[model samples]
Target chain A: MNRDRRQLVLMLMPYLVGLVVLVLLPAAATMAMAFTETDLIATSRFLGAANFVELTTDPAVQAAVGNSLSYLMFSVPLRLVIAVGLALLLHRRARGSGTARAAVLLPGAVPELAYGLMWLWLLNPIQGPVNQFLLLGGEGGRTALGTLPPQWLTDPEDARAGIVLMSLFTIGETFVIVLTARLALPPEAYELAELEGARAGQVLRRVTLPLLAPVLAVLVLRDTLMSLQASFVPTLVVTNGGPPPYATTYLSLVLYQDAFEYLRYGYAAAVAALMLGLTAVAVLIQWRLLRRWASHGIVGAGAQRPGN
Target chain B: MSWHDPGRRRRAYGAVAVTALFGSPLLLLLAGSLREPGQPPVVAPPLIPEDPGFAAYHQAITHGDLVRAAANSMIVAAVGVPLSLLVASLAGFALTQLPRRLASAVIGLSVLAMMVPATALLLPRFVLFRTLHLTDTLVPLIAPALIATSPLYPLIYYLAFRAIPADSYDLCRLADLTPMQTWRRMALPQVQPVTAGLAALTFALTWSNLLDPLVYLYDRATFTLPLALRALAAMDPHNQPVFLAGAVLTTLPTLLVIGVAQRRFMHSYGPEGAP
Candidate 1:
């Protein structure tokens, strides 16, 4: 090999080894391990399809799957819309926009564990300021709207909603990307929109959305995967898979419990296999939905240019 | 852009609303931490305590063993983040040098790797570490650094490095610089904003990571900050203030790191007054 080839290999060796060892090997091993009954202590026994068969009948698995899908359904769209809205609103300098921008990003800067603990207090349902503020207006345990406050920790539905609520504030990464995309667009289009005296809504509909579709498409795909697995921390820390019967027990929690708590490695590997399938299906669905938009987003990649 | 104009005034109001709505949780954390110790979970307590105190923070640090856990967290992040950046930046620069097809294939593989969620790999990693007898040690926690914490970092670096003009590489060749030399001296210096932003994120993520520590570690001595915080809550479920204090301590460093990088990062988005 030439010097260039040797140099390239030398540089690429670490990443290639890392990708294979950390990702590819584990992925393939998960499939194989799904067939065996091993708990890291005993001799491995090939269970054939038994682990997968049991997965089909487990109510816990069923509930975990349902919770994950519901979490994904609600959180992904809400996060996307909010992130894009914030990016569009605060992308430019104006009075107090920097504060708004900082507000948008600061929650994301928070560590997940810290953020989870913060929500544990904020959504405490009893002593939590959220419910307390809601209850302040009424005589009894009701709010001024003649409704009761949400039981964010105890009630099943509210426990799920609280997780999604915690998720909404941490869209800093998404906001930054969308803001850069907005900035990177050819200024001539916006200049033309201004020359034509386009209303803000009109410009958004006709000019901005189409240009940003590509970036949004990618965010949708990435956020879909993120929303699915993002539940591990919250469910573990705040909810503990509770308001029980696995209401907030997402797939990650299920996999975590099966492998780590129960020491059922093979069964957890099967759950992991199912998660991989879910991820593929989710990404494929979004890809088909947004194929046109994603195709052209990478060329310029929202980088800063010389001429605005 | 002045708030005196009607349109701008409406937006300023909008800004205030989001800043209040989304930013209130941190305030709640702060308030809960400041309450006097031994107080019951109060109903509709005032936002500020009549007499705020740091007794909860004191309890959290001593009884919760937070100082040791925090030191462990610092050790992991300090060692792990730089290693991650090194591997990611090297492969990213190498991508710029590789033939286009090979580079695209590698990039495609990297994207696929990113899509595989960390949860999916938990058991295999556990088995791998156990087989190597690295469990209960800090190696499992730090091993992810070799993968750049996520496969996404290399791709981000690839995009940033590719944005540089071809003439710069030509200049490097003319100056008799090797690939590694050009990468360190020329390419790295040009993309300080991206490096700073990515480093801040990597640090924050590493510091906050709870899952690996939860799975691999059982000894209290090896627990990182998040695990220690969880243990604090579990130890005294009724004492919410102590755990809240622990949460506050975890957030400050991550926020400070991001604040240091935010100005350069914000400038990279565009010069001020883009409109």
Candidate 2:
């Protein structure tokens, strides 16, 4: 038993060392530095709560937080809807299903920088295909095509929309997860529903959806957490956080700029803390919501007694 | 299952529509890369370039120094992916053998660790690396992989290892195999699919990573492919074709990996069942 314990610790040593040096140490340092003022070159001085206080009133930081929240609000639901929708559509084995599934997964495999760049080109106002297609009505109508295409990267509104659209294609991971969950659903419930002469929509509402609710809830929480950080990349690559006014600047961008660009490590740490707190709150709220959902017996009752 | 069902037909159409809408950007990218340079740029470049050639690709590679940056990315992946897998898997396996209470605590800590976003760690990690004099080198970029900085991979490995029956360990004891030997002979073989999945996932992630490389490496020589692509984008913003070519080059290897391991990748996400 002792030998086994020793061996286990030996095996775990590398990760334990890593956990301390890499994750815990940095996290501790970040928490500590959140209360002090330092620029790495200068002598550090404690500034308790000043950073957080400034964050409350700072216009740029406020704009960034707002932008991030808007992104989370819009992107998470859109991504989940698209993911679940695609998973349902592709879960069955039908003609062309395999090819369609591969196409959906392709974007997720592309590098983020590459993916952002591709969107940058596609959304370009003057010479992009998206605008061109919008312009050419192709016998349906020529009326709306005459108007100028939206300046996706330049205009602030379109830029945010562009980011959201870019996000939709990378639903490969969520799609696979939801697909697995959907596929794992018992077929007996569906057959029973069919025997009762239930329509497809009724079956979906009464049986399929309730069964997949847990997975969908988890996906929502996961996507929400991811949206907070993942928005940083596209904003950085595509918009550089802006066409002035810092329109696309997100909280992650703010933290990055504060630390790396402005050399205000202390302020950045505080911002980082806030971002972490926000994520924790979001996750906790989702957990509570899931628990409440469970308590209501929406999922468990349906799962245990399907199609009653 | 029901070919004659109208709902199935609608779903099939919906699937095709989603694919077309989502897949058009990539098709456009491919077409744009093949467009002839110096053609008077139009309002919406043609889907099929009138005079297609390899000129844009040639220009991107030569001017962007893509070869060097790609080499740097290769170095990072070659070292980082395996190290991450080994460390995470070892930690995962160890968690199974430790007392249940300690294992849960460790698992909880790792889960909490995972919750801390990478952005939150960026500034402090930068400071830590600066203090260690490891900034501007590839070391900072590669070092995170050693610990499997994100707990997701380790958790995956833990769940995979946990699915193995406890009787395997008893059998190892009956055979007088050391725990290490037991892991090698029994557990490792059983978890090959998980290992492959994790390794591929790690490789693709490391290969595509831009933020870490951007924060850590400053010099052109140390730049990864993503950074190199960013540099190329900045240098020639007007030349969309060249930019697309560079983007294509950056995307190819990852696409190839996914295409080859596509089945295994999907299987990895399937329901975990006891063996």
Candidate 3:
């Protein structure tokens, strides 16, 4: 028994060491630095709550927080909807479904910088195909109205939309999860719905959607947390956080800029702390919402109960 | 569900449409990169370049330092992916052996670690590494894999191990195999597909990682492909063909990996009929 214990400890030692050096200690330092003032080059001085107080009034920080929230508000739901829609579309073994799935997954496999760069080119106002297709009708002829293409990266709202659109393409992982969930539904339930003369839409609305709610809830929470962090790369690479006015600057980018660009490590740490709190709050809210839904028999509860 | 079966022909057409719509950007990237460099910009870029050549590809490789940055990315992925897989799998196996409460606590902490936005760790990690004089080196970039900092990989490994039947371990014990030996001989063989999938995912993650390398490495020689691509984008915004070429080059390895491991990737998520 002792030998087994020793072997187990030996096996776990690398991870334990890593946990201490990489996660626990750094996280502690980040928390401590949140309450101090330092430029990274200079000696640090403790300033209780000073960074947080300033963050409340800082215009850039405010804009960043707002932008990040807006990004999440738009991107998360759009991504989930697209993911679920595609999963439903490709759930069956239709001809060429394998190829279709691969196409959907391809963008996600691309590096972030490359993906952003591709979007940057595709959304170019003048010569991009997206605009070109919009200008020309489906028959490859110009539209009668001569509509002008929107400047995607230059305009703030359009830039935000572009980021959201870029996000929509990377739904491969979520698509897989939802697809698996859809496939896991007991076939007998569908057969029973059919035997009762239920229509396809009715079956979906009653059975499929309810069965999927639990997975959807989890996916939403994961996407929300990811949106808070993942937006940084595309915004940085594609929009560089703006055509001025810092339109696309997200909280992660703000934290990054504060630490690396401006060298204000303390202020960045405070921003990081706030970002962490926001993530925790988001998770908690989702947990509560899921519990309510589950109790109301809108999700997993329905999965346990038989057909009405 | 039967009532909504759009006819087979229509479903096929719809699938084609979806693929085309989703694939156009990458297709455009490929087409744009082949365009002759000096050609005047068109009002709407053509699906195929009028005069395609290897000039942009040549310029991207020769002028952009793409080869060097790609080497750096390869070095990172090559070292990081295997190290992460080994560490995560071992940690996961050990967790499975721990008492129930301790295992749950460790798993909970791991989940919490996953929830923490990676951006939050940048400054403190930088401070720690700088104090250790490890900044500007690849050590900071690779060190996190030692603990599987993302937590997801270890969780995946744990789930994979959990799927093994208890009788298999009992049989191994009856054969006089120690736990370590049993893991090496029994569990490792059963989880080959998971290992392959995890290795591919880890490779893709490390190769495409931008923020960590951007924050840690200062030297141009040590820049990863993404950082190099960023520099290329900034240096000449009008040189679209060159930029596209660099993007294509950077994405090729990941695309290939995904295409090759596509089957194993699907299986790693869940069992054949289970989510």
Clashing pairs in 3: none
B1-275: candidate 3 lDDT, tens digit per residue: 45656656776877888799778778888998898874677777676988888898898887779999898888878888788988889888888877778778778877777777888888778878888998888888788787774677888888889888999988987897777897799998998888877777787888888888888888888888898888888888888898899999999999888777877867554344321
Query: Which 10-residue window in model 2 chain A sums to the lowest lDDT?
Result: A138-147
Residue B71, candidate 2: alpha-carbon lDDT? 96
Question: After TM-score superposition, what is the CA distance of residue A132 in candidate 2 from its true location, in Å?
Answer: 1.4
Name the runs in model 3 displaced over 4 angstroms. Answer: A138-147, A302-308, B1-7, B38-40, B267-275
DockQ per candidate, 2 decimals: 0.64, 0.56, 0.61
Rank order (by DockQ, best first): 1, 3, 2
lDDT of 1 by residue, A77-143 (tens): 9999999898887776677887888888888887888888888888888778888888877768998
Task: Write down the TM-score for model 1.
Answer: 0.95
Residue A238 Cα positional deviation in candidate 3, in Å, after optimal superposition: 1.1
DockQ of 2: 0.56
Instruction: Compose the digit string of candidate 2's lDDT tens values, residues B1-275.
Output: 23227667776787788779777878888898897755666765568988889999999998899999999999988899889988898888888888999889888888777777787788778877888998778898788786774677877788888888889878988998877887788988898877876776787898999999888888899999999999999997888889899999999998887776777756554334111
Q: What is the C-alpha lDDT profile of model 3 across A54-100, one tens digit per residue? A: 99998778988899899889889998988888888777767877688
lDDT at A211 for candidate 3?
81
Instruction: After the best TM-score superposition of candidate 1, give how far the Cα of residue B48 lies from its true spot, in angstroms.
Output: 1.1
Best by TM-score: 1
The candidate 3 chain A region of ten consecutive residues with least summed lDDT is A138-147
